[model samples]
Target: LFICIDHVGLAVPDLDEAVKFHTEVLGWRELHREVNEEQGVAEAMMGTGDQLAENARIQLIAPLNEDSTIAKFLAKNGQGIQQMAYRVADLDHVSAVLRERGMRLLYPEARRGTSGSRINFVHPKDARGVLLELVELPKEAEEH
Candidate 1:
């Protein structure tokens, strides 16, 4: 079952600039940052509230390579919101449900995401033109 809106993924042309904008201008805290070579993107998580709290946050993602999905997104649509992520209690069950409902999953299986969460995306066409993500966070990361 779905827990909550985990984070909003934003595609940006420049990762460093986006991080600087959020941290320096908006005064949001940079919770974490990392480069996911497998995904070919560099990402940083920024939030306004408590770091340990389960709150909606922004995930700034930029292309790490020309062939990355972020690069293609920037090329086709410029920089903007890319995906809305929902945290799930059981990713496998959720995936099965989606498949049973005939929804198209972008990935055949869950893949490693930021902060070591298992993540998968639903095809945008099946989600009313907006890409949707399902994330299963590590046990230790869950709120009490």
Candidate 2:
């Protein structure tokens, strides 16, 4: 079953600049930054507050190549909400249900995601016009 909102992604022009702006100027902690070539994006994760508390995350996304979706998104709509991620128990099962409903997926199947989790994206058209991401964390990652 679907669980929780993992984090909201924001498309940015530059990952480094956004990281600097959030950390130096706003005083947030840089939790992690990594490039997922398969996704064609460079991502930066910023922690707004302690994890023990109700803290949100700032995810800055920048295109790694000109052909990237984020690149096209910036060219068309400018920097803004990229996608919303939702945690899930079994992505495979959800995929079957979505397929049975004729919903389209951005990825053919789930793939390794940031922080070593598994993720898949549903098309905006099928997700009520909001790009939705389904994520399943690795067992080891979840144990922590």
Best by lDDT: 1
Q: lDDT for every model?
A: 0.90, 0.85
The 10-residue segment of model 1 with minimum total lDDT is 47-56
What lDDT score goes with residue 10 in model 1?
97
Residue pairs clashing, model 2: none
Scored by TM-score, the top model is: 1
Model 1 misplaced stretches (Cα beyond 4 Å):
none
Q: Cα deviation in Å at residue 38, candidate 1?
A: 1.1
Which stretches of model 2 miss by more than 4 angstroms? 50-55
How well is each residue in 3-27 modelled by candidate 2, as lDDT tens digits? 7787789999999898898889999
Q: In candidate 1, what are the lDDT values of residues 62-127, reduced to their tens digit?
A: 999999999999999999999999989999999999989989998888999999999999899998
